[model samples]
Target: MNHKVVSLFAGAGGLDLGFQMAGGYDLLWANDNDPDAVSTYKANLGNHAVLGDIREISSEEIPECDVVLGGFPCQGFSLANTGRRADDARNVLYLEMLRVVASKRPKAFVAENVKGLMLMSKGEVLRRIVADFEELGYDVQWKILNAADYGVPQRRERVFIVGTRHDLEVDFEFPTPTHGRKPDSGKLPWVSVGHALGGLPDPDSRHDLTNHTYSKYKLRFNGYMGHRAIDPELPAPTVTGRGDNKGGVVVLHHPSNERRMSVRELALVQSFPLNFEFACNQSAAYRLIGNAVAPSVGRSVAQSLQQALKTAKVAVKGD
Candidate 1:
């Protein structure tokens, strides 16, 4: 963890943790508006997080860093919500990210969002986002990356936008997945819900595992809950950020038990370490876990960025 990084919309510090796990990143500053998320981040990731709305923060107040990263709000662009549109007010938060990168003028910048972003306004939103970075003097590259492909047990698909400063003379290369569905070509098989949540104490067992407790809300008989009774052998479905107040969408059943997966199990499925404490009520915990970018996926991208920067430095020395 050597390079300085400023993270925005850093919900529960999932993306920042991944960059740390990948090594070569020093999380210097992080900002998030959610109180619970900020508490969790400061507790686990250190005191770097500032609780506030990004639109209120002046870029000059933020320190210069090697990279600026954000998993901007995707609620307005996620498929789970039909009202998603390019003009949705939340969609403009990427401009906040753009503001950070433009302010820091870092060597590189990374932005992640729901996979739906690729199809937003028939690709106009995506084009504009990339073009925004280009306007700030970066060479941008983007792709839809699956969490399952990065060793997470959940099948989360996110679009990563990488921008390298033109002076770096190096193109940012997205990381190749270390694991995939087939386990061929030297790749490992996709990790399963069983692999992530197996052997944990039953939700009723009252295990002391952090955030592993069951929610107070009983399962409804209605059709809102999608993908219950998960297959132990396959990757779990995407975790949604919505809470039970909206009749909760992610109701994961235990592979061996009758009860649904606990909050800890859900976190594990998202590739979060067991010891990583998520601070909040049971439902808020779920929302934070669901909203998180898988750390394993973040690490994969961070490692790639490190290599790309190293290559650029070496090339410069050669010249």
Candidate 2:
């Protein structure tokens, strides 16, 4: 059975695309406040994505679905945001996700956030979040997953919290790493930046690639976030929305160390399809791509959920 899904805080539809690629998900509805992200999502994914703040939209407006998916705003829970605080107003956004799950009562729900969430307030924040879901009778589980482990060329790590309705009697298992730093017997080596961006033409030269443009921000090797040079032999570092201390868009140094990776290249590293178009300007495109959950990682998680649900269905039939 194809599971209907309602996506909240759906930035550029990366996670939604992954669920679609997994083949058993139907994106019934999606909501995001960013106009540019909504435009890009509509252009490439579908017209279901709506632009509006989740807080203003009532649960009655959202469609009922088998699953709920969201990667809520993570800046307040991100270590990179030096000003991260337990009291940051944005940190409470997850409660909005919770509010929906409580109202919709989907069979399963998935929430994603920055890795810092696990460490926030000495892990108290995560504990409270889990407890809140459990209060709604869900068997909740959460883990930190690295994007590179699931074929993304970047080593981005994020926390995924999965909850299955208690009555469903299903345990959601996180997907195993298919690629690793040191490949054992069956695993593949981590995809390198060079491998992911192998055939792309230079941004300076004429190219037909969508969003094949780079930021003109001067290279600064001051050992800050976006200024460091990328090693072609290894996975690229996490793509971030902010660059430097001044909060400009992050444009990581190309593997060549001569220039920053073009928007297309960064999107490629995030495992977005080459044909996927960002309907926004260069800076906005960079921010959207940076803030997105890598499509490859999302696919892995979706596939795992599919297996677990199938298994539970079979068990229920037998009973």
After superposition on all C-alphas, the RMSD of every candidate to the true structure, in Å, is 2.7, 2.5
Best by TM-score: 2
Q: Candidate 2, clashing residue pairs?
A: none
> Which candidate achieves the best lDDT against the true structure?
2
Instruction: State the weakest 10-residue window (summed lDDT) of model 1.
Output: 310-319
lDDT string, candidate 2, 110-159, tens digits = 99999999989999999999999999989999999999998889999999
What is the lDDT for 221 in model 1? 37
Clashes of each: 2, 0
State the TM-score for model 2: 0.96
TM-score of 1: 0.93
Q: Can you tell me which runs of candidate 2 are displaced by over 4 Å?
A: 244-249, 313-319
Regions of model 1 farther than 4 Å from truth: 220-227, 313-319
